[model samples]
Target: MKAFFLDAAVTLTLTAAITTMAACVGPGAEAGTVTKGKIYASEAAMDAPLYLYENNHAEEGGKTFSRSRYSDPQGKALVEEEVIYEAGKLKQHTYVQHQTEERGTIDVNDGKVYYVFINAKGTKTGSDKWNDDMLLPDMLGQRIADNWELLNAGENLKVRFLALEVQDNFGFKIFKEGESTFQGKPVVDLAMKATGFFVALAAPSFKFAVEKEAPHRLLKMDGRL
Candidate 1:
């Protein structure tokens, strides 16, 4: 299956992985910047959250570390993920699905991406060489930040993204959609779509709301996650 971070192309089960990755903060992590957010079914119907997530970020020994936990509305942990970055890029990621006891890890080494998953079915492993512009899910925000100017200038940004399920990389594009208000705050709307010929035909586009000012914090996202 094709996956582009928070894009709707991913299956519902993969949404858990997407949220786990997005909740990760980039390098220059701080200890007290923990934040919590709710995942709702839709923007208009916010009566209750389908799931709640918590993010804790920290810096240790020159590496940025992030831990994210997702829970049901009744407060039972569903999935938990830990991610580490070195020099502002993803180093390794591990996640656990509490209910199924399924666990997996993604590692980058010597220009290659490695994945290992364990479940009742058995242990599965896969690897593929990655390009310099290839991004792990946690790096999506930083990528957007790095290309902020181009996006604001109405330029389409293209990059490769790692799809953990397939243990492969796929091309995707990001561009500015327009400007709008989200949660009463001024924001810029951005859209992401798969760029590969076949994937593009089937993959659904995704939307994001980012703060208009400097730092350009992401205010909201609308996708399968």
Candidate 2:
């Protein structure tokens, strides 16, 4: 597979991962034998679940999506993010809040990644090209590989695998706070500190819950940005 890196001039650091609620459905879904539009639980002991499989949206060559509304210190709508994916690849990602608005696409082929950025007005602004020498030659799959390596190296589970959408001059400090239950399933809690040059002096924090199984899906996530 082709291996590429961010151009040296681009010094931004960002990490990305899917955050969603897990719901088990379909026949034999409890045993991870998914059929049709269902998510099956895995019985295997997974250090980290495969990214390709974790994506409920990518499962059918269709779109899986989520959206969030951000609020200001005064509890007013400030920004919003609508994350979209198709067959495990990010098809369209949009973030509009405050004065910052961006829309972009992430594409990976044969180990090479192409990141194209467009402004809110729908004009191409910049693009990045890179390669990964790990896993399947796809963006989401490569992230799963990277995250597994980090987990094996004892990296904190709080720090999620980087996604192309969020890779721009930012630092993530993740803390594993404790354990909890989501939808009656066991989960681990992670607190994230997002800090970067473009971010304000007061960095925002977010919370995440990960399933305690092989795939370690994001059971639920809630935060105020």
Candidate 3:
């Protein structure tokens, strides 16, 4: 599986597995799962997390839903995002930046993506063609899990990932970096970088560690959250 980071330079570290649910949904609905992770300033100093993230996932009516919240050390909300998917494809994503009061939404429809942003100034909107294989930040983990075999075989894969903040897509290449031990468990290391000329020079490469065993659960990600 392939892993992608959030911003051009930020870093994220997955300290736990997504299946390790921290909470559950209410009655009459499928049980929800919660995964929590920490955001670090850099990989070299993971001694403490600069921020914390929690993702809650649930399924209903053939569709999957996820809500993620990011907060500072004191628990002050920074950003909140919600994503919906159908059959493993993005359906909609909406987020709000509490500090800036910036809100946005990305919707996929009929091979196209529609985006809208609202802030102190006013509302801005745009659209872009949706590529069939385009990946979103929230989909990275699943994509990696789904393509584990190809990655394990040493295949370097190229993918187009949607950058919701810019309402555009960027090219990226994912390759196996090597094998290592993380948190005392054996893991397969993978790395990804921007493929575009200018992006390749400016964007820092990201790394991921996944279990070497079956299911290949993500152990850590060294890049922006």
TM-score, cand. 1:
0.83
lDDT of 2 at 30: 21
* Per-residue lDDT of model 1, residues 1-225, tens digit only: 112122121111112224343642555446656756666665455576777767678888888888878788898999888888888777898889999998998898888889998888888889978677777666666677778999999999897876665666788888999999875778889988888887766566667777788677665655543
For model 2, residues 167-201, the per-residue Cα lDDT tens digits are 42234555567778866778666665654544424
Give the CA lDDT, 0 to 100, for residue 56 in model 3: 74
lDDT for every model? 0.70, 0.38, 0.67
Please, what is the TM-score per model?
0.83, 0.41, 0.81
Show the colliding residue pairs in model 2: 4-131, 12-169, 13-169, 16-162, 16-163, 46-214, 49-215, 58-88, 79-97
Most lDDT-accurate candidate: 1
The parts of candidate 1 lying over 4 Å away from their true place are 1-21
By lDDT: ranked, best first: 1, 3, 2
RMSD of 3: 6.8
lDDT by residue for model 3 over 80-126, one digit each (tens)? 88878877678998889899998898899999999898889888888
The local lDDT score (0 to 100) that residue 68 gets in candidate 3 is 80
Q: Which model is ahead, 1 or 2, in terms of lDDT?
A: 1
Worst lDDT window (10 residues) for model 2? 1-10
Highest-scoring model, TM-score: 1
lDDT of 1 at 62: 82
